[model samples]
Target: MSPSAVKRKLSSSARSVSPPPLRRRTDAVQAQRAAQTESTNHSHKLNFYSWNVNGIGPLLQKQISFTPDATYPLRNFLKAHEWPHFLCLQEVKINRADTATQRRVELAANAGAQSDEPTYSTHFSLPRDKYNATGFSGKVHGTATLTRDDTLETAASVPDFDLEGRVLIHEFATIPLVVINGYWVNGTSNPYRNPDTGETQGTRHDHKLRFHKHMLDLCKSIEERRKSVLLLGDMNVAPTRIDGHPNLRTSPIQHVINRADFNLKFLDKDSETGLKGIDVFRHLHGEKKKYTYHGRGRPWGESCDRVDLIVASRKLVDDEAVVMDTDICDNPHDRGHSDHVPLWVSLDASTWLNQSESKVD
Candidate 1:
């Protein structure tokens, strides 16, 4: 079946499942007591934040060159807010030589005077193997995840999908939840056609489709094992028209090259397990027109899109332990740092990580 047909089917099926009711916040006095008891209880909620840094080297340079009084956007933002327990970054773009230095700087900036060594452990994935064999320098381009809870350990990555440093999987100690961080392939255009065969040349769009298909298969495999999953990153595809400007449906840009491919890859349910993906942001703020990425050289409202996403299993959404609060960070300070804004969500770690009986959809 065509991708659009699959999308329609998924949409219709989704409507059949009623959404979970919202929970009420604790009263002020109750909140105070909860805060007092938070330290003793291991059931506190956790925060998860994800961002596409574009290129880490340039961002670091920008932060370092700032005048004493001038604010380092990311650093200041990290210091100003209460840090999340888990932080995932995409398009980090750093090589081996720069990893240590970059990590130290980031840790120090985020740590502030709180500690010399922050509690969070960091991991990075760089392009390797065939990628380097193609004369591609394994340099500044990758993904990284930092977690305050040491229980989350690195797991095996999807074989071919990790070529461009695009995927990272982490398994939690007690929870059946697996966090998948991805910087999906941005389908770029290649106008060159084969002269002899008169067939269109394969572009990055092909790779994007393949990557997404493999990712779906991987998620299905995880679900078969009865594990709950949370997939977050710069997916490079707006799952619905509500996700970006309506004009993007026809845009000639590389990222939006084959909209059908994206719809087919992400919108369809897993054929084997019947597992479907849910957009955490849209689920919370339906039809809200917010953009996380602004076009280069274009004014704010003139050209922008929401390519970053956080998708979770249906069971995770229903359990109320996976995604709590989600938003696109478009503060003035964060805007100047990168063209893409940060997307974050709050996770009820205690319930999600400890509740093994939680169903996996």
Candidate 2:
């Protein structure tokens, strides 16, 4: 079936099921403030979705089944969530030399061709180093951003950080907003070594720290310009103990341990600038044990963590620009889609965009 037909079928199926209720807050004052804000700004909202698709090439291949009931997770996801104006994807793993990879990119770029859905202007950042002599094919992994046509005025990648195609930045034409789609370096395999001692300097832990520092500096520069920024991706870090699996050891060898440390540094308020970030999902759904990634291909036990996240500038968080319902799409039935599920956020564009304009004036 065509994309449109698949969407129509899914729409019918979705109507039979009701969504789960949101958790209630104990603080009455906070609830009252949120109610007031919701009443005032109910008209303008923009949905954003971020997924580390694991690999676009593989997803496209798996989605080509002939049976009607065969699970085409990626295609079904796109059809079901038509509200997202911006879709950010990571670990696309599309190399320039692969023709199949080129075809998959083209299909994604022209996703709305046969339907009434809004077309997206796709931008990709492939690895700068084409040849992979290091045995680790870091050059094949990449990130992508697909924004509604005419929505973006400027788009580019960070200089040093773009080496492995890990980051893509998009600036909107009318709004003072910058959306950064990133696939942070997974330092698990690349151990940091000291030149003088000829021993392990910091292991994968040190490599991740350096990566976070670069990301922090880049985000700081954008916020310095007074733009309301939304940075979303597989950060590869779970902020606290609450975000990590309880059974996992909090050791240097453990990825969660090192990643959590860097997460704190990234979210820390700068002494001079006083800028900070708010993890939107955790802010809304406090202490909810939602896991976005399942480690070692285990279903969901002690190996899961909420590594995928959407972090926004404090200005946007303080202004109540986020429309509360953030989620981790962890569907066990759709295992073939990816190991890491998608995370999404809804933002009140009218409120934030106006506030940003006033800052300029």
Candidate 3:
């Protein structure tokens, strides 16, 4: 009785002590690691917005200005549509009379008073004259950046082009993005006259060539520094005659009307080989009316042009970037905003950084 019973008990204890199968243990370990990785990547999704608010003067004057009453619609839009992570504002002007401290305090107060969340990093790219000269003398013709200010990484603004304050660059997180907010000088209608040069420089001839060269140089510089870049704001040049109605044809300059060649040659083309640059915009909104600026005096009382654009490097598009709906805002009519729409685009930080690292080889 003792030998048989003891042997049976010993056999049961031996079976219980045996370790689980190797494959099963490996599967459990993998599942735990997968969950950990997922948690680590739970970063906030980026949302960006850009607008040329004509001139901030009309909204708020004096040393300090507030526009919550005027920006009610904008604030409402933000709450309704989920406010963006960053806002790139063009035509943000500060009176030359105000001191830097005065300007900052006033703008900050205005922003806070207007919206639920105020921008943390304020990068004001004043015009070239002001860039070197002191005081806010000439109209500050550049860009403004407002960030959530919650992120660990700080924000910065880079001026891509300095000729008459046409470009401003901003970066958020490790995402090195270049924002060129420009207002090119051009004609009023078909081919309007140059207020200064009259013939030598209008919307068509050498004026465009010179301005475009500067923009191209900026793009090249951004490419050299940042792995991914976005060239945006009021380009003022139509890519196709179809960009605006044929009946509104005001300019005889064929090139301005036909933007395909121009875009393909400089923007889409590779510098060395003269091949096409990435058609990033087309990839997102094809054939859709992405027109940002419009005219009011047409026969039908309405005419449109696609001037403002958000063009990204091929790498960003291929890796799946985000572009919000490009809609024309109503503030232009009342708040002295420019006759253009506000647009947005979101980039996946993880995807971009990973791809850039891989390309370093």
Leading candidate by TM-score: 2
- TM-score of every candidate relative to the true structure: 0.72, 0.73, 0.63
Off by over 4 Å in 1: 1-43, 58-75, 96-99, 102-111, 115-118, 129-140, 149-160, 191-201, 249-258, 268-274, 319-321, 352-361
Ranking by TM-score: 2, 1, 3
lDDT of 1 by residue, 159-205 (tens): 45466677877755445777888888777664323334546657656
Model 3 clash number: 9
Specify the highest-lDDT model's number.
2
Please give the distance, in angstroms, between residue 45's alpha carbon in candidate 2 and its true position after superposition. 1.9
CA RMSD, predictions in order: 12.8, 12.8, 17.8
* lDDT of every model, 2 decimals: 0.60, 0.62, 0.48
lDDT of 3: 0.48
* Candidate achieving higher lDDT, 1 or 2: 2
Candidate 2 residue-wise lDDT, 59-166, digit = tens: 554455566434334444655776366788898876644444544553544433333333344567666543321224543567776554322234444456556677
Better of 1 and 2 by TM-score: 2
Shift of residue 220 alpha carbon in model 1, Å: 0.9
